[model samples]
Target: MSNLSATSTAQNSSTPIVLTIAGSDSGGGAGIQADIKAISATGGYACSVITVITAQNTLGVSAIFPIPLEHIEKQLDAVFSDLNVVAVKVGMLADCDIIKLVAAKIRQYRPAFLVVDPVMIATSGDLLLKAYSISTLKSELLPLADLITPNLPEAAELISSDVPTNKEGMEKMIGKLRKLKFNALLLKGGHLIDDENSNDLLILPNHVEQLNAIRINTLNTHGTGCTLSSAIASYLAQGNDLLRAVQLGKDYISQAIAHADELDVGQGHGPVNHFFVGHANVR
Candidate 1:
């Protein structure tokens, strides 16, 4: 690896200086922690503003600490006034006010890539966002997005109904989601299991591509969604195509899951290997 100076890094910063405004996961498996790791792993400088803090582990989320609206704005102000942010990845926007606040800031500083991960539910079946925030995200946020990455359940919540389990059903759901006005939609299929592989669909303007990966067999698959979205954001910052970024992001998550170790923190599910530790970037 070449040594990178802060000045040279800042001056010759890669194509994107990615930003993620999301909640914090204390376990460091997901949320802001995973975002930074994913961004760096994809070779981008990550700037983050936390929307809320979750006292969470592999077992479950215990408490939620929401930052004040003004504090969230202040964090954005500090970053926007100084650093040059290239792409924005939104994770858990906890409330309606946060959705509106982030939407306004994003419009003011329209970055090259705006990826929205409408984090309504986690893999552990936790309700991360409120009902009204859904409206705020659709009305005030989706219009400003370059890409919207929604998992199966999120797709259902976004369209206000059930998402189809098969390819045909996915097409119908993607159609409903496209009405929200995003340039692209990466409908993740982690929750959808047809046979064995976890298939994700990327719906762009002229075409749709299937991103297929063998599902790593492990219960230590927490934070996979957040990791994928942030990894894509980081790649976008580094000037990768949207489809390529998503593809690379999927590969990264697969590796993380395959190499996931027993952190032994929680009893139910385990966290992914974001650090990738002895694990190669096999994807």
Candidate 2:
């Protein structure tokens, strides 16, 4: 595993810097846009290194253009060289090369916390990561993550198993997931549509935790994964422990989803209100 330990840095600034290395959503709902909103909303300074650019909106992803590998490296260098980045949230890496490049940079910089959101498919059912890149992601990138947030489909893809439809099915996959080389796993159970409550499993090396919240019924669920992971990264950057950060992130996302109806964005799945509580700190 790449060095999971954070490199020492001066603690002079009050606002913690959080960097997000992900794709860009032109719709301004998910990807880099959502990460920035979530980080700032949760009281962290946000920075980004966009890996891919998508012509996307609430409806769906129309087209994708991966940034050149050289430019991607330049973006990583620009952020890590200047900012005192405390945590990183990775999402929507387009291919094997991008994934490998990102893993190399993380090894070199060794940020304090690494949150990997294995974004294989968008909420609209559009494929994000290439089918062949799954193996590269699991082998080269995931093992380096401090925490990997994978939903049902993503988890199934990582393990080459069937997607779980219920709590029992989710539990059965625990042993399979434990075999993977990663520090911690947050198995998001939001895909269980039949359940009235949303429950997520946090699988640590020594312990397993189940986080539960009442399901908020809404069609405006676009960018939920991106928002939650970025919120967790922001909390981690602000010095919260892993468990605390996950809990806080869950709360923020639930609220955002609950209040999602307030925004009337696109024709299909709309975005959650990142600033749902007005200008007040989301924490």
Candidate 3:
């Protein structure tokens, strides 16, 4: 571990510093792009360590190139050595080697908050993580997480079964995830939009809570999972409790989706308006 105090870039020292370790979306909708935007919007200084680079847009992912393991290690070392990173939000890890490297680094640095978004598949049905890496993600990286955010399909994959679409099934899914021994979980119910309300399940060691929101019907649903995880990480960096952070993060995404139509980006699934509260239009 590097001496963070010697290289901290905090102008005020009091402002929270949030680090995002993920892939880069050339379209600037998801991955490290969305993570940076969400962290900044939620009042945290954003730092990034790109794990993979993807040629993707609203339509779909065309190609993905993983960053070299040595380069990835250097990036993590650079941030931990220089930044006062209070919280770390992890996104796409392309393979088992990358996952192992990340887990080792996290164990060394020991940030205050660690939020992992199990990004296996994209909204466009594109695969992000390799199939063989799933076990390493479950057994290694997840244990280090302060919070793990997984959508319906992701939760299903983790448990090796079909994810329940209904409210009752979602509840049971949360229970199953709890048995995984992770510190906490934010079981995202964003994919369960068939119902009138989209309810996310937050499971801590002690209790479970449901965060309900009226489903916003929109084609611009890209990067929502990344955004939500980053937001929670920001809030956690700012000293909010886990449940409170989850709630605030949920609120941010809700508004972001509500105002997504204001921006006319790509033709397929567009991105949520992360800056919806302040800068409404900047096309």
For model 1, residues 1-283, the per-residue Cα lDDT tens digits are: 0111113333456445888899999888889988888887767778999999999988778888899999999999999889888778999989988899998998787666788888988778899999877878889888787778898889899889886777678768866776777778888877766548888888876778898988777788778888888887776666566667788788888877777864554676777877676532322
The estimated TM-scores of all candidates read 0.90, 0.96, 0.93
Better of 2 and 3 by TM-score: 2
The list of candidate 3 runs beyond 4 A from truth reads: 1-12, 278-283
Among all candidates shown, the one with the greatest TM-score: 2
- Candidate order by TM-score, decreasing, is 2, 3, 1
Candidate achieving the largest lDDT? 2
Better of 1 and 2 by lDDT: 2
- Superpose all Cα atoms of candidate 1 onto the true structure and report the RMSD in Å to 1 decimal: 4.9
Q: Please list the C-alpha lDDT of all candidates, in the order they appear.
A: 0.79, 0.90, 0.87
lDDT of 3 by residue, 1-283 (tens): 1111222333335878999999999999999999999998888889999999999999999999999999999999999999888889999999999999999999998887789999999999998999889999999899888888999999998998797878788887866787796888888887776788878888877888889999998999999999999998887777676777788899899999999999999999999999986632210
Model 2: residues with Cα > 4 Å off, grouped in runs: 1-12, 278-283
lDDT of 3: 0.87
RMSD (Å) per prediction: 4.9, 1.9, 4.2
